[model samples]
Target: MVDAHRTFVIVGGGLAGAKAAETLRAEGFSGRVILLGDERDHPYERPPLSKGYLSGKEDRDSVFVHETAWYAGADIELHLGQPVTSLDREARAVQLGDGTVVHYDKLLLATGAEPRRLHVPGTDLAGVHHLRRLAHADRLRNVLAALGRDNGHLVIAGAGWIGLEVAAAARGYGAEVTVMEPEPTPLHQVVGPELGQIFTDLHSDHGVRFHFGVRLTEIIGQDGLVLAVRTDDGEEHPAHDVLAAIGAAPRTALAETSGLAMAPRADGGGIAVDASLRTSDPHIFAAGDVANVDHPLLGARLRVEHWANALNSGPAAARAMLGQEVSYDRVPYFFSDQYDLGLEYSGWAPPGSYDQVVIRGDAGKREFIAFWLKDRRVLAGMNVNVWDVTETVQGLIRSGRQIDPDALADPSVPLETLS
Candidate 1:
């Protein structure tokens, strides 16, 4: 009972696009569904690329979002390795790279972000790498294994999540790793200096050398292979490979060219969308890392690049596209696994957004729950080596209730009671 007249087209072949297509069917939308992707591989999740896959604990097959036959069985017309070259907003169509133009009644852009490249010299060397895509991870995996076996060195630029994760993986493989960052501490922007020190200590304990308050200026290579990297401080570190783990920028070129409203760069630029995930054009919607949402509860526009955002936002956008009332007010959530430590973070509390950081349990032992509060209200929380309190932590944020700092910092006080 599929409707042939109305067509729903999804661009990008990541988790967001794949989940949206699945949700459309689950919601009983029997229209023609077309999904376009630039990569030849089927839709897949990204968390494993940095964690299990890179660490040699998971196989490649575990990354795919669904079996190859699932798309065909779902009646989802998937065009892989064909990128959308241009968007025709007026015609309500998009032209593929191979020159095929497909019209849509409703369009969803789940196009994700790309890793920001290091513009330093010798970046074109053979051993320099970036890890935003599966291809990159595949190559880096081999490189890390080789470097580990040979006792080679890896110099990483920017001690962000990607860098630290890779550093941990390399250490597990017995490779010498050094991280260079312009910030004074690791994850300075996300967790702030107060919590960043925890990561600094963690990585340090694992033999990962960190160069803080310094920028990577150049990569010295010999015959197209990385040899070492030089920093602004005039120190050179021997390196068999260099990884640029700086950050990622949203893919907004197509949206901008189609004349869609864009968020300001200051607000983390992307396609501007309201709470319903609707863009300026009613027929078009956006989700995932490419969409900057004007969040209702946060009262701020946010563009989250984490796996959880993609997992939730895609289905939310699918419902919105089906003419269902939708409010995507889910607090941003993400988790990281490093060595023997695992942590889950919920809600948003970028530095300057909170006034105090209250910790329960022992930070020195790396088993604690840290709450970032502003005006006695929990803005965000992170649980390290702590189990199954994500629900209670998110509840505190959603409740927006003023909390007693002493109670929040006491392990004896249950978070459920506070909310």
Candidate 2:
């Protein structure tokens, strides 16, 4: 059992860090719990940044993880807008941005990620934005609302979830949007080409143009504001604004500088940890996007950048920190809302890992469950516009039993039968 007197410090005040602090207190740890976040706002949800919040359907306070009173009542010291500068492993101290050193008996690094910035020329121009922080979302939301019911051109670089969702929201605001992707299809790496085409069709049907197999070469500006985007194909697409949604990189500089062992470069470069989320230093643990854990299900070290992982991993880390035996073997899961489609995906199978995809419902109808299988065993499953089946889908992946392809692709055969 962990001594109640030990001070526990948690860095990064995003959902993961907040969840860790909540877990520590809820698990009967009477120790001092301190959460340090660089942002001015308290721990908040990021998923809404692209959906309800960005579209003006939700307000600012709805995004927060908790109200101000919860932290004080929990006896958790909340340090907002204090960026941690360095970690001294031997000294058991963390240096803040203001050069103030704080000591702790145990530390948890839940530092999330930042949107990968575009490197092309003219990226600094006005009206070119990337949605990551609340402030950024607020600005974009204002822009979209100002152009309400009027057609404006929005040039989006990279057709990932953020780009696509923003495109949908812009369309709702009467903006003519165009998305460019280097891949042949959007999100082909995560979901296979077949499933990716469904999204492409959905966007195309709504008049969102696509420039596949193309890269943004430059952002053209007039009077220090974005006017157009130039692609490598020598075509310049005029735009009133631009959004670069390539992807995100984990904030691992603190761990890297502190000499924490990193995962193999192929696993996307995060602090390496075992199934229990324990870092090389037993006193320290890493969770959320900053942690590249060895997953027993995938049988490989994988780094997941999803809200579900962020919410679940911290509690597992807290339990393990308290000397309770724990293994975070939960199947990876994530969801996306694009236009009218609501998608929930469970289990993780990297590209080329799954042999085939079995569809149990019609893709054209936009309501169905698709299963990715390898060696006749389910690897992952996705439900689109379908309700209350995620647990059953996860159960199918965990069962590890050979399943009939015909039955897997038939709606008449219940999922529980396969399990």
Candidate 3:
């Protein structure tokens, strides 16, 4: 008993697109649904590609959010390996690379971002890889296995999530790793410097070499093979392989071509989205990493490329498309599981702008939760291998209660009692 008339078309088969389609069905929308993805594989999780999948510990099948049969059973037509070339906004149809245009009543653009490439020379040399897609991970896995991780030198450029995850995965395979970060702290802009310092300590203790305030000038290679990477400081880092995880640029080419308004950020690229996740075009909507949703609390538009974001925003977009009113107000939360150290952080404080940093437990021993406060309000908190304090601490924060600095610093006093 499918409603065969009202057509709903979703582009991009990543987490956001897949989840949105599923939620549409669950909400009793039996309309004709078509999901188009560039990749042939089923909609899979990309987060594990940098960790579990790359380490050869997790298989690619485990990366999918739903099985192939789920799409078939849901009566949703899925077009994989078919790259859409252009979006016809006026006609409400998507033109595929194959010269076929698929029409729809409602269209969704969950097309995610693309990895920003290294501008330095020799970046195109062999043995230099970018970790964003499953195929990329598979290629890197084969390269790492052949290099015999125990002694291979992995020079990772950029201290972002992909780079750090690759470094941690390489270390899991016993590869010697060196990470080059232009910023002093890896999560400097996100969590602020204090909590970012604790992250540096955790990675450092894991035997990962980190260089801050440095940039790669040129990559040296021999006949298409990477040999060494030179820095702005006139230092050359020789390595067997290079993991370039600088960051990602929003895949706004299609949006840009469609004349949608691009959101401006002081740091550069991001696509603008309204309160309901609609773009400049009232007929279209966007989700996932590509769209910058305005932070309801901070009154700032932020683009988050975290798994929780994809999972949460997908349903929100689906609801909005269905003419239902909804708000994307979940405080941004992200986690990095490096070696045995566990890090979970929620919200972002103003940069270099915390009045006080309350610490529970000891960061020296690598067990503590740090809260950054501004105007006696909890702006952000980071739990380093300290799970017991997260829920309670986050509650106190959500309740908008001010916490005592001394009581927070003492491990003897549980964070819950302070409120």
TM for every model, in the order presented, reads 0.99, 0.98, 0.94
Q: Model 1, 1-419: lDDT tens per residue?
A: 67899999999999999999999999999999999999988999999999999999999999999999999999999999999999998899999999999999999999999999999889899998999889999999999999999999999998888999999999999999999999999999999999999999999999999999999999999989888899999998899999999999999889999999999998899999999999999999999999999999999999999999999999999999999999999999999999999999999998789999999999999999999999999999999999999999999999999999999999898889999
Candidate 1 local lDDT, residue 231: 91
Report the candidate with higher TM-score, 1 versus 2: 1
Give the clashing residue pairs of candidate 1, or none. Answer: none
Q: Model 2: residues >4 Å from true position, as ranges?
A: 1-4
lDDT for predicted candidate 3 compared with the true structure: 0.82
- Residue pairs that clash (backbone atoms under 3 angstroms), model 2: none
Candidate 2 RMSD to the correct structure: 1.7
lDDT of 2 at 185: 94
Model 3 residue runs over 4 Å out of place are 267-269, 388-391, 412-414, 417-419
Model 2: per-residue Cα lDDT over 265-324, one tens digit each: 787778899999999999999999889999887788989889899999988988888889
* Candidate closer to the true structure by lDDT (higher is better), 1 or 2: 1
- What lDDT score is found at residue 113 in candidate 2? 86
Model 3 lDDT per residue over 1-419, tens place: 67878888888899999999998998888799899999988998887888788878888789999988999999889999999899878988889999999998888888998888888888888878988888898899887776654477888999877887787788777778888889988867666676678768777877889889999888888988878788898898878888888988777888888778888866334668877888887778888888888767556677888888889888898888898997777777777777888788887665766788877788788788888887777777888887855667667667666766777678888666866
- Each candidate: what lDDT? 0.95, 0.90, 0.82
How well does candidate 3 match the true structure in TM-score terms? 0.94
